[model samples]
Target: MRDFHLLIDVGNTFLKWGLFQPSAAGGARENRLESGHALLEEIPALPAQFAKYPAPSRIVISNVAGTRVRAATIRVLEVWPDAPAPYWLVPQAEQCGVKNSYRNPAQLGADRWAALIGARWLLGPRAAMVVVCGTATTIDFLSADGVFKGGTIMPGVGLMLRSLHEGTAALPDQGGEFDEYPTQTVDAIASGCQHAQAGAIERMYAHEASHVRDLTCLVSGGAARAVTPRLAIPFQYHENLVLEGLYRVSMSL
Candidate 1:
């Protein structure tokens, strides 16, 4: 079987992965063999996804999900006939030209660290603010000098909306389109949640823009689209920020 690369990014609620064929040095890069996402509980499809590519020569994973989900991921890998050596990328004080500002590097989520590296490497040194919106929302900062200034984490749109349902009797636990003025309760919930998510990000972005010159804000994660259009400040949406970071780490490895 031809050798390839595998990138797995496990978040709170989803597992995203990619299979890639190697590229020529400093030349045009080939795209991934396949890239897709699946909810953690929908993991039964793992075998099909794995069958889409050749056995990987390199396998790097960043898993923030706890032991149960990690076990689930490993079980998925068990189906591979030629299982490659897997490296679970962990948080470090610094790596791949980026410095860590977390007082205890181990406390930093590997996924978050990877995103920062991905941002710095993808976007040349300018101040960077990373917004990852998934089951949770994280807003983190990075100085132009490659220091990984710590970030903020909060419940995501789904959680926030569910909170209302769980706490109150009338609010339904469902999502709707974002609207400035909503005629229905669901839309109102969606608007309020989106505004809240957007507000937190803007607050951080505003602060960074105030302190840094020519700042770059990068937003990623599954729920990114939910709040991105509402961003009051300029930003860029990267669908595979974590994968990009994983690729960066792979290169160094």
Candidate 2:
């Protein structure tokens, strides 16, 4: 019998879902589908996205919010009423063939867990740095030995911009394209935010390299496209690392 997998990544602002059929090698199925929602309330509609495909035998979720986590659980149960309760992928000692390297493994963010798992799969067993820029920008370093060394978290592009406006008196609420170089104050704020994030990751990449060589940087998250082009170093973007990790976890069990 074929195995069906459902992967869900619930972030601060969005919930990303990926559906796949397990192949013989325990990798993703050939016909994969991806979708997402902005509101947590819309979670109940999740099953509709996979209605055309086969029902998933296993479900994996990585949720950041407790309330949303509860909501997601309910939604999944409602959708797969007949299936077993979905597995919540928390930061554990071992998962998806990767061992947790943190001192307190449980403290590691689920999103980070997904990134490390996806990074190992994408960059092989080599030392790698994964940068996820979204609601918050996180730069995680995975040693050459496949151990997750640690990572840094900072205000993301949108959060930084919103904070500047809310916290400051002179700065106005401004927005611009992240692709173009800034010419004016608004553009400057936009570019500054983008460059600052990209610069931080570049510096982190360099810092990680002082101890480990041949480090591969993998960038992902919603704001990945905005900051990726500004970085001085070469990196690969995985738009759905969390979702991909969830899929991998489902295959494991």
Candidate 3:
């Protein structure tokens, strides 16, 4: 079996790519994994970066944007024109080791599905709450038995800040940076947006605590640093859960 894998996660704002090599027994800690960010328009650059690794027989993708999907396909064709097109992973009601419990299972975001997969692998099959704070904040719950119970979706910190300025009149157009306890106008906007976002996560944790015995929180994405300090529960931080999930899915097939 080929030991190399390529994982791609396309989001609303950026494209994240990761390369992973299977670990030897007892070599898990030394496994090689490389990842970085790229603009949606810069998809063509991926093939060159990936050239450093052995030619990957398997490529997995979780794309959220139609435009990005089209562009990425074109770029891959331009470079690996003869190679097999990458397999796209869409979240379903059930998949390799996890079952979705969403009201309409397919409606769950692909990123959420990937996060749940990666979270289960890291946190074990315990009751886990995976919070991905990116362009959109997604809070997904996986039961102790590895069942993906339905989760929540809310506007992310950046989206909320942007919305406040774009949707309303009084709110100032401030960048995303909040003080420990905001007091000024800008700080107020920043802190208000931060707390509001963090508050929603807190509520979700509370809601899950009522039903699950052991609630493990896993936080990831661009906005995690902004919200982690405010979270009440002890949580694990993963910089690229979606990408890791993509890698895991590819390995299963």
Candidate 4:
């Protein structure tokens, strides 16, 4: 019946997607039917996955992986020839109630922009610090009134460890478990990377808390497991915020 809406988030390290059915409540709370994710190399599996479902009425996408992946995604999406052209999300000055304060709004990543909208939907009017730990760790501040102030990005946990190993001669490529005080170099590297992510998030949280009362921290992305434990403040983890944001966008159509 072409009732489904497919949501895809093409991130730097992975391409994640969800097939959702409209909710009786609202779009922000849409019912997810099936979801899957794969590394960049596994793009070929997408068509097979989607083949199991009926043709969707609409396709919503947020791609930040650049041209090659964008082309790859478009290629795989040929499985549903009858579906409407995919809606590629582009960040704007404002969308779905969240206002982007980027000096140049177009330069902001679609994934980040979507996450901000999702955060606003999830958190309502509360001030929030949205932290995403993926290929790059992003720390963003969203005011209670739905304005996206600005944020910083840094190398993610694996990226930090990889850079140390690749850029140096003696460092190990694989990091050890997180430890406060480690005598081993592997542990030190792992702990340092984790702490760096947590420290930056905490600092941003504190900064936002100073300006707004009852600031919330919403954490998401692949590396949330490694970094969330190190955070000293309270945070709510969402595994598919980008998809949530994409679904919200799909509601507008």
Leading candidate by lDDT: 4
Model 2, position 246: C-alpha lDDT score: 75
Q: Could you give candidate 2's per-residue lDDT for residues 1-253 as a string of tens digits? A: 2556677788877777766776645444344644555556676666676456556687788888677566764665565556667788789987766778888898898988987887886677799888888889999888767788778899999898898889988776666665465677777788889889988998988888788878888889998887888999879877777777776777677
Ranking by TM-score: 4, 1, 2, 3
Residues forming the 10-long window of minimal summed lDDT in candidate 1:
22-31
Name the regions of candidate 2 deviating beyond 4 angstroms.
1-3, 24-31, 47-54, 178-183
Q: Candidate 1's error at 98, in angstroms?
A: 1.3
- Predictions in order: lDDT: 0.84, 0.77, 0.77, 0.89
Tens digits of lDDT, candidate 1, 12-80: 888999876666342112456677889888877787767755667888999998888888888888767
Which is better, 2 or 4, measured by TM-score? 4
The TM-score values for the models, in the order shown, are: 0.93, 0.89, 0.88, 0.96
lDDT of 4 by residue, 1-253 (tens): 3488889999999999888887645553448877889999999888997787878888999999899999999988899888789999999999999999998998999999999998998889999889999999998889999999999999999999999999999999794988888989999999999999999989888877887899889999988999999989999999878988898888877
Off by over 4 Å in 1: 24-30
Write the candidate numbers in order of decreasing lDDT.
4, 1, 3, 2
Worst 10 residues of 2 by lDDT: 26-35
